[model samples]
Target: MTTELETQIAKYQKWRENLRVTLEAYQAWLEGHGHADIQRSLRIYDLVESLKSDRVILAFLGEFSRGKTELINAIFFSGYKQRLLPSDIGRTTMCPTEIFHDPSDEPYVRLLPIETRKSEESIGSLKDKPVEWVTIKLEVDSQEEMAKAMASLAEVKVVDVDEADKLNLLNDSEFVTTTVIKQSSGKVEIPCWRHALINFPHPLLKNGIVILDTPGLNALGTEPELTLSMIPSAHAVMFLLGLDSGVTKSDLEIWQQYIRDSVSRRIAVLNKVDLAWDELKDDAEINASVERQLDETATTLELSREHVIALSAQKALVARIRGDTALLAKSGIETFERMIADEIIPAKQQILRAAVAREIGGMLESSMASVRSQFEATTNELKSMSTLGDKNRDLAKKLLAKFEEDKARYGRHMESFNT
Candidate 1:
């Protein structure tokens, strides 16, 4: 069955494909009609390419263990019949991870070493230098191999406190003690990678949907690139919170500092609602408890109640893998997916439409003006030739001269326009 998100993405992809075809046709027309100047052709080419490679980036933001990664797995990767990313208890995803499909490259996991943080280069810049990253090829045919490669997302290494501090993985105070683990060897544990990029060929990802799964507050606070560039660039941000914990201080801090005002669309995901399900209570009572938490979360986050969603990502994944329709519906994942399909995807389409109109609209207008000018010139020349049939030889010669002059002027105008 086609999911709502998949259906919307299919529509979006079709729309984009149609637009690309139209632009390509326009470019061919310009070439056929001698209007295809280098500058004009290049502009059209760039626009077409942009449409071809366009992506909708949705970033998930929250503190550690909020089910951010789990929600991602349930929503997008449940088809594998297993958890695709590491979402175990206690800080699994330690660095920012981007999951998208790029057919130009084979399936692979690329990790940038944490030690690279010592350099002034940003993650965006480092991505251009392949040598700077550790590449792990994914065996897409084997689920076990793929899972093993993906487990590297949670890979951590023991380092001295001084090294951890230098890498910005440790704090100077109580936050450090709470967040980082100290070994008996007097060494601190830190993430093995500074950033991770997964180029997998998932269906939705292939249709130009990019998912960014961000780490908790400690990583967000330390990585300026994430808070400064990545989060702000996302089309929408899903701010996940554990229903059991409600809104923690760190979650609120992440919202205020990194999420709020960073993106145009924000969804406060109250994950793990199954925790509130009591067998002793009826359906109404269970719903009432979930609603109360949703209200509280919305009020605390200063978001509308509609924007706050409650779901059990773990249960959803289990139900999906087991093909249990009742459990799937009860998990509330469908509701959340519907919101993405109905709201976020359409919003992205509108933005794309406005941008394309702003860009291609002007070129179209200019082409129309040029066509109109040529039509007028042709009409006048035909009128002159008709009049010449009844005129004397002297008048005919003068009219011919006028025709020559007009043709020359038109040629000059077209040359200037093309340039």
Candidate 2:
């Protein structure tokens, strides 16, 4: 009863595991034979670890209320048979969040305080300081509990405007709201945290897949890491937009400003197709409308129709939960999921293969040069030792002949002097 998605996931998992083991053995062999240079060995080791740890990072980028989270839940978490991420109407993911799995760590939600942004520290460096982040242990057995814990990503803490500004969370009061506590107190405010990192035990994530669910342009613009590190390194980036809005000014700005230059494979998603579905009378009308939007969106983004996909993430989630195959097919998630599994994942595997080949090839070349140098030096020494007796005899004969010639010349000089 495994779906194509599940089958592909399993296949990738097997491939990675096999690759890791094979590389580990090769590294051991090279180490034992003393053929591995430190630098080359380290590079090979790092590639092996990367192959083991690297996730097929699928980053979902869009503005608020564009169904970015809903799309994520539909594509990744529908197996829970309910909404895993907080995708309600008003709630928004205020900061950049990365959902991934590290088998070494426990399942928890780690929120980096906005105050830490005042200092010069990357998120990676700050991960070890448990006191600076708020950690919440997750009950992986229950989907509802995990859902409640994940809802905290949208939670805001009330702080003075000055404090919010100092934390760099306040940007012209757009992300925060002004409030009055009482007659005595003046204005109060709530500031969203800077960023969120959630570690979980999801199957896809455990198989080395990371999902970057980014919302709001303001947050994306503020987080330089998103543009410089996360987005650029991701294997795939999906820009989600609603069909009703087509390509809005904000969407265009986000695309042109940040996403357009990304090296990752790009896809323009026209989500919330269910809204467009309701007005159509028949199948023909539905197909015509869907095709029209697809064409229009592709034109707006200056991409081909193949790169533009239209789907209803909400309906897809519902269909998945209810086990409605027909509805799931109509949701268009299967087509997109298939594209990811068959095309993107396989392509990533090929990329990894090339990287492995390059790293191992370098290591082998270095080792071969060292081995050849040692063999040539040893060969010259052995040849010199093997000819040592012959060389000594030849030197004696030459020295004897030179001595007889010098004696004959000395006798002639003495006789001439006597005469």
Candidate 3:
């Protein structure tokens, strides 16, 4: 049986062989017939080769019950509910969890245990049971991963540790580790986690900067050792709350310290407000109470009341899929979307502005996202739009670099190859 490492090396070799074949075929064709700009073709090949190496990581964050995982799946997985992080009512995450990219036939999470190698041969049946840690593999992909990761989406994991309740990690747990290669594929190490959080980057997240999915302040202390380590280094803090509950006493306490005390971006999302829509008769008492809560929450966080958006994460996800901006507004998700498109993108682009010297980065920034397509068509040198015979690439390419730089400081692994 081929080792995983050997398989990976083989894959790399296959890619190289494919490259050689294509080059030989092209060169042969150009030998007899007149071909235009052979140097240009080589440069195009080089760019195509180089572009594959570019990758960014990101993380998602929120409180334990705030439906944070659900939102992550809906947005990042292209509205596909099958792929998500596992979430439920009874504290599912027992350790700090991480997810990294792995493109293969059978998807799996390499559950890495800090203490011991698990004796249980099967990874599909190790959840709920008390064990130290085990590097179990989950047969999942991005979309399927999202479904398993969040509550909003659900699918039958051919094998699920949670339902199996057959294994457990005993003590020390190091849940996440990942390495990117030239093809932008790498090994992602994951472990059995509970109470902790998920703070790693993916393709969607700028750079390798992971937007943290935190365990609301109340629950952070469970893994007391790593909480302070992770929280203090994050780029921004977002407090996800339920609209029906508004800002409860516990939520206020958490905001006052962990989220509000810091000096980066802070946002509060009023989720599940769809529940209140029918009850609130335009200007009813319940509606007024919600408004009051929004104001107070904003004041507590030193943000404008407008920053506290009352939207259904679910509805906003739907609107995004259908490209129904009007429904998004009606569903109240437009505010959240604006945060991603206008604020977050603009800010990150400002930071990554320098990487535009690279073609891939430039195209990513100038015309990468769906929303920006319309704007790029209007053509302006300042905006960096390009139109060639067959390719039209224009985008702001700076956000990835900035995001990666920011995220690296927070538990990025470095190999001592130089030594």
Candidate 4:
């Protein structure tokens, strides 16, 4: 049997690459034929690059241990044939993470120090300073080595209480007791990195799908960018909730604060549904109970039932790796995968196409207008010069004045562009 999941990703990537190639050609034409002014050309160039490198960023948001990372592992990294991102019990993804294809010299893990947050630089700017990042080289040939490298996401470093405050890692909340210490001496445990960027040659990511695996609300609260810029702009946001602990206080807070307003771009996942399933119980009864919880969650979050997906991410990962068709179907991942394939990805593609058309199309129109104006002015000058005597001299003077006027207009345009 063929995997529908693989085919969906392939189709999405095909559309994305086609658009990227067209944008690349458009950028080349603009550079070769368009205005030479640095500011004006650079503005168009930035948009073209954005169109070429654009990917559908799927932001997975939930509290700690809600199976956010596990769902990511099952949905994308299952090709590794083993657990790639650490999903073991008690392990938590402690920072905002971005996973995408690097297409560079090698696959590696780059971590930003938590201390860098004190600087004025944005996260995007800090990415250029490789020295400030703790880099880990990845071995693509061995799944075992890759798995080991993946575990670095869970690594943490202990520091004195004072140091944690200096890094702005300390926050007052009931759910934030984990970072505090009650020992005789003042000490605190905190994640060493503020963010992690994993650039791997994963098939899906290489085709243009970026996954943002975020930590709990406590961690997310500290990073304003996640709420203001990242999550708001994602193609889709999956908010995972534990089956046993449906819509807890912390989970609801994250949803209301960040995910609620973007209902059209969000999916509420009831993860670890296997824990609620039983062999002795009738299959119908088990399903009924799960449905009840799903309804309750949907009501609480004010989302439609279709937006809530109940799935066992762990089972799905295992089923995919072992090729267990029965378990795979039971895992509920197929339904979720279909939604992303048929709806989410295609919707994101339409948005990208519209953006390119709006920006690039505008620039093309502006360039054509400039050319048309120059042509008309030259044609008028030629007609006037054809007449004899004083007409020719008067036309020459008028042509010189026209030339000055055009130059001044062009200068004004360039001046506004520089600002």
Candidate 5:
């Protein structure tokens, strides 16, 4: 059974493959026709490699307890028949987590330690140096083992205020109130890892989909790399807001500071719509109430109503696990998935097309110009030789000499062009 998301990604992958083949054909054409050069060959090679490794990154952003992680599970991991990532009540995903499939590597979780924050190196630079991370192997065959390993994302360590301050984990105004726990021993609790990378072999991930689950504002505020680089680089971003809490001050702050202008394809997800379900009222009443909330949320976030999605991620996951069509339909998960398939993926494809054109369009134009010049020179040489038969002997000799000179110059120019 192919899903809409799977179908769309398959089409995307096929498009990329076709583009690769076209580039290869173009390379052959240039070489066969004597237009290939070192610089042009290198550019083509880099473009093909980039296309082979291209990924569509979807980032989920929100404050804590907004069901962001649960939404991720519902969308991508419902087949495991359990919650893949730790999505508990409050502050579940402590650090930024990136989930993707790297075919060259086995299934594993690479966690960067909190102590690494003391170093001057950013998380982006640390990814290249595997020695800085703690690697945990995952048993893909065992769901229980995989869950246990993934639970480490929520792991925390208690450190004194001084150590916490040194790690930049203690922000008196924001971190203490939102992300950390103050204990009787005068120690503060913080996330054990700075960032997490999970290389799992899921179908969507195998098809070049990267899922980025980010922590709340406290972590976002402290990690400048995430705000400055990662989030903005994602192809699309979904900002979750709970229906029960509406949009809090912290949520608004996160939107303004991190999400609002970072990505072009931004979605405001109104999660936990099941909370509005009432036994005493009919479905119409419940729907009206939900729509009213959605309108309010859209207005608050200053987004169009079409971009605001309302869904219950918990119910959707349960419906998927249980194979309940009714609950699944009511959960509105299918609608959201369709939007991603129909809107986001196509938009990303257009951006990629524009970028590729900008990179290779100039080289192609130059190659065509060189071919045109060579064709004109060859035509003139043939015309000169044909006219030699009707001229006097001396004139014919001069024409032949000029024709040979032109041919030799053309050969030299071609040699220079190829080299």
Candidate 6:
């Protein structure tokens, strides 16, 4: 029941893998031939491999309770109660969270606990916290299965693994006894509990796509993996908003200072439209008001009005899951979905996607020169009396075709996000 978008992403990933195998084969052949021309082909193959694994990471960032989770809901979920990011206002996600695909030869959400590390001997500890990192191996396949992995990360509590032995409740040696540990009258020391360790063999992410759902920038004392690793590596950033709140000074500050600085493409989304529109007249009027606000805000930021997408994350998430666009709009979700297509997805296409591009581009300029050189040599050869003209014509045709094909394939890899 996967949608066209999912299938398209799958196809592109498969194509990339096929190309990788082909390029590897070419490289192997070039090694056997040991000619200067063959070396050029090997280099071209290496370039293709780089392009295939050319990752485009998308990071979600905002303040607590800013509907960052709801925006994730709109993008990743597709059903009734389409809830991806936890939407609790009071308990607004306290830890760093992540949801991504992992297509290992043996796939599992290798949940690396904060205090532990995976090793052959045993779970080891780092800084007097507990033993080291041990991955919580969870098996999964489809999207629904992936949700379980995220939920497991959310549900688990942190306890001292050594303390678990005292309770005689030691089910697994790798299990760390989770606790809120010690509390100082005002300040408290709680045993750290992690959010999630999700891994899946999703077609989109395997070739190099990682989508992150963060609890804004203000979260404390949780895992540092998010800010240190994920954020810095992301190719794009999605900034969510609430329609009731609109664009605030804090939002502007974060955008101008942090998110905009790191990510080349930033998407500003207005969520919770259902609540805001309920207070307005007709749908058109509600939309008009949002447009007006979008313009005012974008102008202040010196960003294009198109950059601020007016959406109901709550609605779009539900609609996509139910495959009901009418219901999505009725629920105020259509706006989010449309915004994703118009702004975020297209930006991905323009930035990272190039069909046979990265490798070919590298080879295009370099290989063509060699091809021409070889062609001249053939023309000058006395043995080419009957074959010189044909060989030269063939090389010329191939050289022109290479670049021509690259230009035509510009957006093929982008089709996954294009919708």
By TM-score, the best candidate is: 1
Which runs of model 4 end up more than 4 angstroms from their true locations?
A: 1-5, 20-47, 173-184, 262-264, 360-419
Better of 1 and 6 by lDDT: 1
RMSD to native, candidate 6: 10.6
Runs of candidate 2 exceeding 4 Å displacement: 31-34, 37-40, 172-191, 365-419
TM-score of 4: 0.80
What TM-score fits each model? Answer: 0.90, 0.81, 0.49, 0.80, 0.89, 0.66
Each candidate: RMSD: 4.5, 13.6, 19.9, 7.5, 4.7, 10.6
Residue 273, model 3, lDDT: 70
Q: After superposition, how far is residue 376 of candidate 1 from its true place, in Å?
A: 3.4
- Error (Å) of candidate 3 at residue 103 is 7.6
lDDT by residue (167-207, candidate 1, tens digit) is: 76676776634335677676988888889999999889999
Question: Which residue window of length 10 is worst by lDDT in model 4?
Answer: 175-184
Report the number of clashing residue pairs per model.
0, 1, 61, 0, 0, 22
Per lDDT, what order, best first? 5, 1, 4, 2, 6, 3
Better of 2 and 6 by TM-score: 2
Alpha-carbon RMSD, candidate 5: 4.7
Specify the highest-lDDT model's number: 5
Clashing pairs for predicted structure model 4, backbone only: none
**Ranking according to TM-score, highest score first:** 1, 5, 2, 4, 6, 3
Using lDDT as the yardstick, the better of models 4 and 6 is: 4
User: Please, what is the whole-model Cα lDDT of each candidate in the order they appear?
Assistant: 0.87, 0.77, 0.46, 0.80, 0.88, 0.53
What tens digits encode model 6's per-residue C-alpha lDDT throughout 383-417?
43434466687665664465445433433312311
